[model samples]
Target: MSTVTVTARGVTPDDVRAVARGTARVVVDDDARDAMATSRAIVDRIEADGRPVYGVSTGFGALANTQIAPERRSELQHALIRSHAAGVGAPMPREVVRAMLLLRVRSLALGRSGVRPEVAQSLVDLLNADITPWVPEHGSLGASGDLAPLAHCALVLMGEGWVRSPSGSRTDGGQALAAAGLKPLALAAKEGLALINGTDGMLGMLLLALHDAAHLFTMADVTTALAIEAMLGSDRPFQPELHAIRPHPGQALAAANVHRLLQGSAVMDSHRDDALHAVQDAYSMRCAAQVAGAARDTRDFAAQIAERELRAVVDNPVVLPDGRVESTGNFHGAPLGFAADFLAIAAAEVGAIAERRVDRLLDVTRSRGLPPFLSPDAGVNSGLMIAQYTAAGIVAENRRLASPASVDSLPTSGMQEDHVSMGWAAAVKLRRVLDNLTSILAVELLAGVRGLQLRAPLVPSPAGQAAIAAVGGTPGPDVYLAPAMEHARAVVTSPELRTQIENAVGPLS
Candidate 1:
């Protein structure tokens, strides 16, 4: 596997994708090790001074006032891990667990978390060996740094939890480590807190979501262009001069992408001077760039936030350079929570508008000469009718998912941890929104292809032809529909369709 080295500035979304997808391993930098050692030395000094260092010497949450003796401090770390590994429900996907491991390791590698260098190295070893801990889908309040899910991850390093082996078999953590020719490290003071404290889980999900949005939004533009040409709509709204007056960067980029995709289309030129083409297209087609561009702008903001979180040192009782180990609220998930919530709203809106386009394509009156539902024999076969229904249901679900989780506060930890971020919930829902959107866009693209094929002698642009060709398979009399829809969604999400379009159209924003 390829390896990505971690520095204090942290990893990028691409790095997270590589590690999560199991294509790469992470290596801590030498400077990070030096910093870790420096922080460890400070922790040692604080221990010698007999000061109550929150997680280092005293109890956690409501029990912070209760101090522990040095002899039992290591035990405290182990106990913290065992107790906080209380996540429930279905196990998270391997990729997400792997991302959490990578992010936690990166944060610890920064050396501010007061962990021994060996602890950081152990996380790296686990990731390199491809042993993923079984992290559950629930139990994080998006505060205290994804506590339960991360604790589940930390437990594997101590050889005290179940793990998925490199061979994709389930086994005990100890057995996995033994098979990999490694041994589990004993937890030291503040090590457990370091392991579980960060925005890694939410951040990981956000990174993956951000990556998905970039592709889907681009695909949205491609699919929208196809729909516009198939419906005989004008591309005049996307002129750069018209966009310059309003000057939203994302709007301009999206408009340019659609306008480029529609270039050299005989179908568009056929009606360029036709005075009777309903004056202008509906909001779904005419304003696609505006809605999609706004989503792009929202995505830009979320990306900025994710980048900021990547560089953050999120552990409590962080070790300072001047030998001071002090507790802080760096672990709060509010920033990430808000970003996730905002992106979900954007994804939902994108899907909502895409569904509208699909509805317009299927309507007999609105679809121009195209047969109802894009079916050759409209009365005998209901082509892609229920497909729009499927898209509609998912879009509705996305609407519900878009409701911000950050605004809802639930007191936990005996009210010691009040005003929880619910950021993890926001991330979870955003993922669902994105998944739904993929299917929604797929439906729209499939409808556009069917409509374009029906246009027959009137051909679409080279980019449109490339999109149709990448999706393959001709539109036919009613067939088992799932496979085509699945193929369309896959092609839309992957680079195959985008690459095909860009090859024909030069480049897209």
Candidate 2:
């Protein structure tokens, strides 16, 4: 069953990854439910006690002093969602909407958002039913809390905007609610603000990015292992005892993994392996453990931030239990904006190194006895020549994108949001980096697979051949790389790929 647990405590990055992978359900604890009710009471008390609050009884943003008549408060709340739903352009991807809904519910679940239990449940219901909001792909400053995109998210709950269904079709809010046999929520005070005022958009993208980045981080090891065998490097470098000399956890883990990939390999045999025929190997081939290890460290570092942000409440003018609403800057995206850029930097570096390895594979000089471009018919076929170009293009694009998005900030809301996080830009760029890195790995995989085939009859290390079968090879020769690459991508995301890779390289048998 799909489930997510919300306690007063925090949600971890691993939890977000689990939800993204479709392995769990989302639920709020009784404590959280009770706390939310108390919070609503607090806000109500503050109102009755006649204390001026930021958003509860007052107007928002530039209109803060413009008193909202009691009769117009609900109208204002509903108007806020409808007006903010002014997001333009194509709807956000279904996966992103899932991430958004997950983050929003988690944020509310912290019991700080002063949301009614029913309001929170409505969000949970949407997620469980796979009801994706028609959030536009653009419009957000990462300040004032991802307003536009989030407003669209809230709109679906009120039965206003369109919603994309689980069956891969789009329908009107009313139609979708009817089809699903659900009723539109009649939102109460502070509910719309809670829904639209949070950092869910930027947070959602980061959650998804972190999840995918973790997957690719592991896969990078698989390709690097293949490259290790293709280069026929010394297994001595990966010896567990040798790595214990320095003992960086990442280094040790990588060494152990490569060791597993090289286990019982005829290719690593000094007397039997062709590697001994050469004097030395390329840096990329020899330094695989060090390079990818650092990337893993980066991933671990960023994971810490994402984990904390995943469940924390992040919205303004939070309604409290004593009916006392408080305004604060928890909605600021700076924390996550920095994380997104940092994750992107890590992703770019990994891709850059993979590109280097790909380059070495193509360089006749660096290729160490392999024909130019890993092709026997080098000049006429160009072999993996253009494949390198594609990889190069991807790396170059990431390099440009790696410029820290969080570093650039501009004000909006008439200076109400002066110190922006630029988080949306960071999340989007990181996602782009993820896409490029996948293609680069695919190119590397293709070259490695072909190189092993050329050394066929001799056979690769048992580890290498098994992994090859696990990937199932790209389609036939004429499919052109882009489609083949997309197919390779789908395969990698499958449970079969990871299981196969693990099985093939397990204990290097």
Candidate 3:
């Protein structure tokens, strides 16, 4: 198993993925422990002095002005977790829950959240033990630090919620902790609030999305190249000189990738100087780089925002190095919200364009000289006709999902959080959009490869042949289209196939 050492310094996206999706153990190092101890000392001072710290001494949100007696302060913290653990909807994916746990530990380990070393260590134990709390999907407004979702996690730490054990058995949190030889955490002043007060949930989803988008966008470039060849489209548009004049970094990279993939292609060579071919290919074939590149640029922008968030201390009443606890609005998730929404829009456009290419590959009028739907017998067998319909349906769904969730908000916590970021919604919807985009690209690959097979006597480039082998599917009378489509999707997502393609064409951007 891989190991990720947590320190006061924030973690990278790869660190999050390792612990979330891979068998990685987590260790909170001494620097983080020391930082947490120093911050805990400040919290102790505030509690000993009985100062009216917002989260330390008083009620929360609209009740901040109300003071609690010292004897009931611990009760206050426990009650905060119980009340805020009111998330609804189905349980989140284990990977998402794990990511949330890891990011929460990262925030607390930074020591600004005023959590004790043990508090952060408890989360580390959960990650290392593979104990994932049952966090629900629909609770965060993307403001107030993913309150409900994080509270569910906090509830697990207190041994009061549900969790999936290392053996994948669903059990009570206390039982799971005891079985792992770990004890439930006792509430301390500001500890519960600290545990639940960060943008960890949404940020985790954003990081995971960014990671997957990197692969999906690269595959988009590969599929675009295949579609260009299958449709007998000109590769001149991908020339570096044409892209150089425009000079968008993503556009140049995308153009270069397609250009490399299509090198030495007999299909492109056959149509290179043929006046019999159409004067210009359709926009979907000719402008593939521009659309996919724009999405790549957008994905990069979202990544920049996620990287900054990874290093941020996103909590209320953060402990300052100057020996003071100050309340701030750093927990607002507008940055992540805007970035997630923007990336969804970009991904949707990529899927939309790919769907167009799929349609073209199935259309006899547009697919150069390929048969209708690439079927051996046009009317006797409907080859990939309905495949285009699937792509179209997903594209339409993606269009609706592309509507920005960040722009919508509702007041929560007695209007204390009057303007919510709705970033959690944006992140969730972005996941769906990416899933839809993957399927759409798979359909395009399915059709594009079949179209290439139909042009058998005129072979494709070496890279194209490698991709066809990677996404293997019989191009004859449509037998069972569903399984073939699923196989194509599996191939699209397989890292091994991506590696094989790179071996043939050099690395894609």
Name the best candidate (by lDDT).
3
- Residue 21 in model 3: shift from native, Å? 0.7
lDDT of 2 at 223: 73
Pairs in clash, predicted candidate 3? none
Query: Model 2 segments beyond 4 Å from truth?
Result: 10-27, 166-170, 240-247, 270-280, 319-324, 471-479, 507-509
lDDT (10s digit) by residue, model 1, range 1-509: 78889876677778899999857978988888888888888888889989888999999998989999999999999999999999888778888888888898889877798888889899989888888898878999988979999998888889888886556566798888888898988998988889998889999999999998998999999889888888888899899998999999999999999999999988888888877877878999989989999999999999999998888899887988877788889899999999999999998999999999989889989987788999988778999999999999999999999999999989988889887899899999998899999999999899988888888888889987887787776666898999999999898888888887888788898
lDDT of each: 0.89, 0.74, 0.89
Per residue, candidate 3 scores C-alpha lDDT tens digits across 225-244 of 88989999888899999999
Model 1: CA > 4 A from native: 165-169
Predicted candidate 2 versus true structure: per-residue lDDT over 80-102, tens digit per residue:
88887876777777777777777
Q: Model 3 residue 66 lDDT?
A: 94
TM-score per prediction, in order, is 0.98, 0.90, 0.98
